[model samples]
Each structure stands twice: as C-alpha cells, then as structure tokens.
Target: MRRARRTSGKAQRREVRRLAAASADPALHFLLLLPLALLHLSGRAHADLAAYGLVEALLRRLGPAAGWLLAAGLMAGLLWAIGRIRRRRLAWRGGLLLAAFEGVLWGLLLGPLLQLCLRLVSLPVAPLSVPGSAGALHGILAVAAGAGLYEELLFRAALLSACAALFARLPGLRGRDRLLSLGLAVLVTAALFSAAHALGDPQALEGPVFVYRFLAGGLLGVLYLARGLAVVAYAHATYDAVVMLWSSPA
Candidate 1:
C-alpha cells in the first residue's frame, strides 16, 4: 500500500507539471505578441521614423508576393495550430460555418447598423457603395480572406487556446479558469486589433469616431468565442470588401 501510494503521488506530480508547461498565460502571451503586433501593424508609420527604410528593406528582401504569402502562411499556421486542439470532425466545417455566419452578421447587420448610427452623429460615412478600383478590390479581398483565416487563426484560435491552457494550470483559478482565459484573450486581441488600426493613417483618429474600432473589436471577440475564428474573419473580410469597393480615389 505504501509503495502504491508513492507511485500514485509521483504520477500526479508529473501530470501537474505537464499541465503547467502546456498552460496558457494570457498576459504573458500578450506581452510576447504585443511587440511583434505593433511592429507589423505600424509598418507604415514606422517608415517615417527611419523605420520606413526598414519596412522597405524587409520587403525588398523578399519577392513582391511575400507579404501576401506571409499572410497566407499565418492563416495556414493558425488553422494547423487550432486543429491540434479542435476535434477532428468539426475542424473544417466549423471554420467555414463560422466564416459564413460572421460574413452575414457584419455585412447585413453590424456594419449597416453602425453606419446608420455614425451617420446620425454626422460622421463622414464610408460609402461601401461599390468596389472603388482594382487595387481596392484586391485589398478588400485580402482583408476578407485574411480576416477569415489569419485573424481568426491568430486572435481567436491561437490566443484563446493559449489562454485556456494557461488557465488550467493555476489551481486557484480552476473553477472559472476557462472563462477567465477566454475573456483575457478577447480583450488582449481586441486591444491589439484597435492598436493595429490606430497605428495606421495618422489622421485616422479624430473626434470620438475611433471608438467604432474598439466596439468592432469586442464584436469580433464575441464572434470568435460563439461561432469560431473563421466566422469573425469572414465578417471582417466582407466589411473590408465593401469599404474597398466603395472607397474614393486617392
């Protein structure tokens, strides 16, 4: 009996260690990713601070297709990483369904509703009237496809999973760990999403309009949790598609 008890204790300890190593620490993960996200998103503004040459230099290091390809790679990696945790049966279907649902929600509901609300406030409207130009069409497509695959993969799939894993490790947080993890992931990802946009245009911020992006971030977070990352990405893509299609000439 004594020997058996000792073996059991050892086994338990080993399992705990495994869990800890595998656990997702949202704050830690966010810190790790924050710098990278800023650097990537601020590629434009950074260009002004001697970072412009760096951006160009980096891009120049690769072929013209590299940026798009890098985005594609991120999408692929996200799917693969998420698949590691997701049940096999629902992987593809779930992602597709999510994408579809998000597309409808953003295009038919959220985007329009927000537009109306903003209009009431006399904000300059993004017509989303039509595909403005070929480049715009391409950008829209990129955002849509990127949102569906890359965004979901990064924010929803990877980040959420990491949080869940971390939550499982802390004994004190056991009962509500998963929920806590999810919330942290959403908040961090949303912040990054907002920051990513904020780093752009420079003139992008004025009045209270910037709040829209934050709200959109929350929506995206909820979408990922309820529907899956793919759905949010789809919604994101559709929204971009419309905006690009209708954007005024530069």
Candidate 2:
C-alpha cells in the first residue's frame, strides 16, 4: 500500500508540472481570451471594443441573422479546438488560476514602483484613463481585458515574433546569440508597444504617461517572454482593473 501511494503521488506531481508548463502555450492564451471576445461581440454596449465595428459592418453586409450564424459557427469551431486541448493539458488551467493572483498582486506592487522611479526626475505621473461613473465599472473590466488580450496578440505575439524571427535569420546571431536576438526583439516591440498607445487615447501620448508606458512595456515584454501570453495578458488587464476599479491612480 505504501508503494502504491508513493507511485500515485509521483504521478500527481508529474501531472501538475505538465499542466503548469502548458500555460505558456499560446493555445491557452487564445482559450482565455476567446470568451471575452465573444462577450464584446454579443453586446452593442460593449461596442466600445476594437474590431466590433468591423464585425458590425460584416453583420450589416451579411444581414444580422446571417452574421450571427457565422459567429456561432466560428465559436463552435474554437470551442471544439479548446476541448481537444483540455483533454490533453488538463483544460490549460494552471495559468488561469495563477493569473488572478498575479494580476492582483502585481497590480498592487507595480504602481508604487513606477511612481518612485518617476519621482526621481520630479515629473508627475499621468493617470491611466478610467471612467468614474458607477455604471462604467463593468466597462472598465471589459476594456482592460480587450486591451490586454489584443495588445499582447499584436505587440508580443505578432510583432515581437516577427522581429525575433528576423533576427534569428541574420548572420552571426546563431546558437547562444539567440538570447541577444530576443533582447533586441523585446526592445523593438516594447518601443512599438508604447508608441501604439498614441493611436487610441490622447492621454497615453503625454510625456510622463508615454515614458511610464515605455517602462511598463519593457517589463511586460520580459514577463511575456518568461511567463507566456496568458499570464502577461491577465497581469496587464488586472493592473488596469486595479487602477480603474479600485480607484487607484496608476
């Protein structure tokens, strides 16, 4: 009985390790973000989110009922794929739980750290734009999730991946030089990440805020590389949620 229990314990540990490792997979990031995307699609009030305009245009072109059918089909396909992953990796759950803890804990820690750094230069920090109305609270969470998921997909997954791939192809950057290449890619993407904010919110482009975002982007770039997209996305979203929902001026 002792040997049997020991064998079972070892197996459980191995399963836990495997599930933890699977959180880094982009597949899980997609799984985490998909429901949020669908939520944005379902409600016209959530219309403030990105790409809803494009999808809405599609609905107009295809007819509203037809557009929904298409959306349903796509959702079904995505869910089926996620189900396969669930069976393979324990529902890709490790990071999902860990993300909440990371989001809340890091969100609390990051603000003071950034403020201390900025205060050295005697510059006042810019507040992240958050709606103050009681009803806008839900909107705050939705926007945070959208921003985190979308920005990570754009800046980290697509842009950073492209930059890293480009560096890998350059001569004399082979072998352990991969780290150097990745470092460069992170810088390239972090710069773009900061700059991209200018396209959305005017406040984001202000001097103090821009610098804040650049620094934050750099940290997120490193975090994304280490923890993968799901962890980083949740961290970003939760940080924003903390700032907005908790009434903290980050």
Candidate 3:
C-alpha cells in the first residue's frame, strides 16, 4: 500500500511540474509578440531589407560565433523563466531536441508542404525572400528568438488561457462540455493566427494553405498544451529560421 501511494504521489508531482511549465497569461504572451508584429508592420525598415535583397547583411554584422552566442543566451533566458515557474531544469539535450524539432523540422518543411497542398486547389505560392549572407544568418537568429518566443507566448499562452478561462466561467460546462469549449478556443485562436499570417502576405496560400495554417495552429496549440510555451516557441522560431535561411541564396 505504501509503495502504491508513493508511485501515485510521484505521478501527481510530475503532472504538476509539466502544467506549471506550460502555463502563462495569454495577454502577456501577446505582449511578448509585439516586437515581431511591429517589425512586420514597420514599412520603411522592412522595405529596406526587401530592397537590399541581402539575406546575410545582419548576420554578417553579428558574425557566426556571436550570432550563436545570442541564440544560446536567449534560450537560456527562456529556460530560466520556465525554471522559475516550474522548478524544472531544461536539460541541454531537451533544449536541443526542442530546437531541432520545432525550430528546424517544422518551420522549414511545413511551409513547403502547405504550398504543395495549396497548389492542388489553385493557390499560388509566396516567393521565398531572404537577406544577404551576413544579414540572413543574423536575421534568422533574431527572428527565431523573437517570433518563436513571443508568438507562442501570445497565441498559446495568452490566447489559450483567455479562451480556457472564459470557457471555464460558464457554469453549464462540465467534462465533455468543458472539453468542447476548449476545442472551440483552439479553433477560434487558430483562425485568428491564420488571419494574422494572411495579413502579412495575402497571396501566400490557397485552399491548402488555409488547411496548413489550421493544422499548424492546431499543432502549436496542442504543443502548447502538451509541452508548454517553450516547446512551441522553439518550434515557431525554428520554422521562421529555416524559412529565412532557405529563402536566401546559397
């Protein structure tokens, strides 16, 4: 009996740790996302890069070593924040794994996949643009940091939390109803996320692209639920980084 009780207690503690790491206010998450949104909206500055057609300029300024250092520092900050809340150590291995899966795998590959799917339905592809070598590398690093961390914070943490909170308030929701409400939240937020991207580039998708956004948003939402902000942020950042990197001339 004692052994059984200990196992149960240990399982409960583990669950608690996971939940704590994943929790964040939806609004604050959105606030973290402001810089990227602003960067996107900043016409002159954005146009400067677009006009230069240099993918590597900013990256050159930082240099490879320095750019990596910056990435490491940002990752550390993210882990530190997670630790403070959950009292869990984000091991280097786990960090790397998160970076590999979310940052590299999803960001780059998903875009193309979605594009292919959209083609079937007659949606045109958005031409990939990148900075010069120096700028491209650095831009990717910075974007990975900003977009990955901030967007996840906004959509997954703030948006999800708000929806969940709002849903929870209705007394009639219980069990299955509560689950349905949460699903509704995910759907609504996913639509908003898709809309946000559509605003950035109208011609970026077709029928398949819409499906892609929906799936990606849902994937992020689920990741937010399963792994917390850090994992999703890593994935988001990685995705942008790849897009920036791949878009650049080799």
Local accuracy of candidate 2 as per-residue lDDT tens digits, 139-219: 666766666666677788778889999888887776556788889999988788777666657777778887787777777
* Model 3 worst lDDT run, 10 consecutive residues: 46-55
Cα deviation at 2, candidate 3, in Å, is 26
Model 3: how far residue 96 lies from native, Å: 7.9
What does candidate 2 score on TM? 0.72
| Candidate 3 Cα RMSD (Å) | 10.2
Per-prediction TM-score to the true structure, in the order listed = 0.49, 0.72, 0.53
Candidate numbers sorted by TM-score from highest down: 2, 3, 1
- List ranges where model 2 is wrong by over 4 Å: 1-12, 42-80, 86-95, 99-108, 116-124, 130-135, 171-176, 247-250
Candidate 3 lDDT tens digits, 2-118: 999999999998865544433343222333343443443333232323212222365577787766875686577665555543454423333334333453455666566657756
Question: Which stretches of model 1 miss by more than 4 angstroms?
Answer: 1-102, 113-136, 167-172, 203-209
What lDDT would each prediction earn against the true structure? 0.51, 0.68, 0.56
Tell me which residue pairs clash in candidate 2: none
Q: Could you report the Cα RMSD, in angstroms, for every candidate shown?
A: 13.5, 4.5, 10.2
Question: Among these predicted structures, which one has the highest lDDT?
Answer: 2
Question: In what order do the candidates fall by lDDT, top score first?
Answer: 2, 3, 1
Q: Best-fitting candidate, measured by TM-score?
A: 2
